[model samples]
Target: MLNIVLFGPPGAGKGTQSQKLIDTYSLIHLSTGDLLRSEIAAGTELGLRAKTLMDQGILVPDEVVIGMIDTKLKENRNAAGFIFDGFPRTVKQAESLDSLLDQNNTAISGMIALEVNEEELTKRLLLRGQTSGRPDDQNEELVRKRVQEYNTKTAPVAGYYANQGKYHAINGIGEIEEIFTEICEIIDSYATQLNA
Candidate 1:
């Protein structure tokens, strides 16, 4: 399977590029945020637990997230591949994901991170805030804090993937098509290597 982890900070155009990648690659998009919402909407046992925690302003445990991911994998067993977005935020979570994928006889092909400058990210987020109606995106300080939080917490996840030789960084400041081309090139290279 051509599983990919689409990594990027807030306002890095991950949402835009993720849609294009899904169309071009025919990969199931497994976004954790979406998964959580779906699970809650379904009112599964795990979902109840997660909802309770969320309602109490506490983070849902990793195992809960992993369980949701496991369910998704089973549901999409016939999928060509998966594109993971906004997940595996820490090294421990990354390791857990690797173990889970291994159990399914699949592995992450690579993580493609969109590299964007802080200034550009803030600009894009503020512009999006004008329309997105997301409070965090509307505030410059919140946007910067989110970006810095990603850097602080998720940078090590990048390093973990780097050690496994499954990290790919691409410039995210160009035209959308251009950026997508760069990402595709990286993904295609991995595809070629895997099939070889």
Candidate 2:
């Protein structure tokens, strides 16, 4: 399997690039946010739990998120691979993900990080906010805080992948196609190594 963790902060073009990667690589996109929403939409047990927490303004526990992922993994057992987006926000979650994947006899090929500076991310998010209608995206301060929070929380997840030699960083300041090309090169390299 060619599982990948698509890592980036808000407005880093992860959504855009992951879609392209999915098209190019035929990988299932396993976004936690999307997963939660779907589970809620389906009104499953996990979804009800997640919805309750969300309604109460509390973060759903990692175990719940992992259970959702586990269900998705089983549902898509015959998938070519999966591209994980917006997940493993902490080292503990990263470890949990690793253990879960190990139990399923597959592993993440690598984490592809989109490296964008704060200024650009803020600008992009602010621009997106004008039309996106997300209250957090509309505020410059909130955007910065979100990015900072992402760095503070997710940097160690990057380190976890780095320690495992599965971290790949690419410059995120460029045309969409160009950035995606760079990401593809990294993924292709890992795929080659895996096949070899």
lDDT against the true structure, per candidate, is 0.86, 0.88
* Best of the candidates, lDDT: 2
lDDT of 1 by residue, 1-196 (tens): 8999999887888889999999999999988867776777899887788777654434468887888799889998889899988888888889999999999989999999999989999999999999976555788877787788788887889999999999998988889999999999998998898899
**Residue 131 alpha-carbon offset, candidate 2, angstroms:** 2.1
How many clashes show up in model 2?
A: 0
Off by over 4 Å in 1: 37-60
The residue-level lDDT of candidate 1 at 37 comes to 66
> How far is each candidate from the true structure, as Cα RMSD in Å?
2.7, 2.5
Over 4 Å off in model 2, which ranges? 39-59
How displaced is residue 145 in candidate 2, in Å? 2.3
lDDT of 2 by residue, 88-183 (tens): 888999999999999999999999999999999999999999997656678776677778878888878999999999999888899998998889
Clash pairs of candidate 2? none
